[model samples]
Target: MRCGIQSFFFLTLGGAETLLLTSMAYDCYVAICRPLHCHVRMGRRLCVLMVTGSWVMGSINSCALSIPYCQFRAINHFFCDVPTMVTLACMDTRVYDYMVFLSTILFFVLPLFGIVCSYSQVLLVVYRMSSAEGRWKTYSTCSAHLTVVTFYYSPFTYTYLQL
Candidate 1:
């Protein structure tokens, strides 16, 4: 019970972070690639919807943590996560393991792909800018976003996709 709760929250928070980063990447794409339409494309309602969607997807991913486990009481890791929980399972957890993998792909990998595509478009726009000032500004904005994505996703994907 305790492990399930811990894993659920951990996975949920991780999912939210991933989706939020993806959404930020998309925002950058719209701002840089379609500056005129960025306001309309990323309106207040759209921002709200994106946040809600992130949390919903996170909750769905965490739902896979509810598998039967052995009588083990200690988690090897600092916190209870899917990998640690899997190690505690007495039954064959291949299916659950696969589910975790699929969830990682869905919640982590797909968003990463989207982020890459978004930045690619942003880069193309930045490349064609008439003013060096504008180009530098765009690059500065994107570099910060990319840095955050790298710092957050590096450990996240490492932890979840190791399965």
Candidate 2:
């Protein structure tokens, strides 16, 4: 039961955070790419929908990853995540590992791609801006967000992708 709860918490939290970051990337895209439409595009309704969708996606991910475990419970990792749980299980876990990898691609790699695309457009716009101050401000805003994203995703990628 504890392992189950841990899996639920870890997967749900990771997915929610990932999707929230993607939503923020979209917010940035709209703000920079469509400044005039920012008010309309990112209004209260849209923000709420984005946040709700993130949580829903997280829940769905956790549900989809609900693989039954065996009697053994010798968890060697700090957290009770999918990989560690699979390792501790008595049965073969190759198929489950593949599923985790596919989910990672869906939840992490795809969002990172979207973020990169958004930032690429933002970069183009900032490059074309006439005011030096505007360019600096945009760069500073994006740099801080990117730094936080790097800190969040790097360890996750390393932990999940490594053999």
Runs off by more than 4 Å, candidate 2: 43-70
lDDT (10s digit) by residue, model 2, range 29-122: 8888898898787778866775675665456445434566566457777867766766666666778778777777877889899988998999
Best by TM-score: 1
List per-prediction Cα lDDT, in the order shown. Answer: 0.78, 0.76
Write down the lDDT that model 2 would get: 0.76
**Whole-structure CA lDDT of model 1:** 0.78
Q: Which digits, one per residue and each the tens of the lDDT, describe model 1 over residues 96-150?
A: 7787777777778899999999999888888888999999999998999899999
Query: In terms of lDDT, which candidate is strongest?
Result: 1
Query: TM-score of predicted model 2?
Result: 0.84
Give model 1's TM-score versus the native structure.
0.87
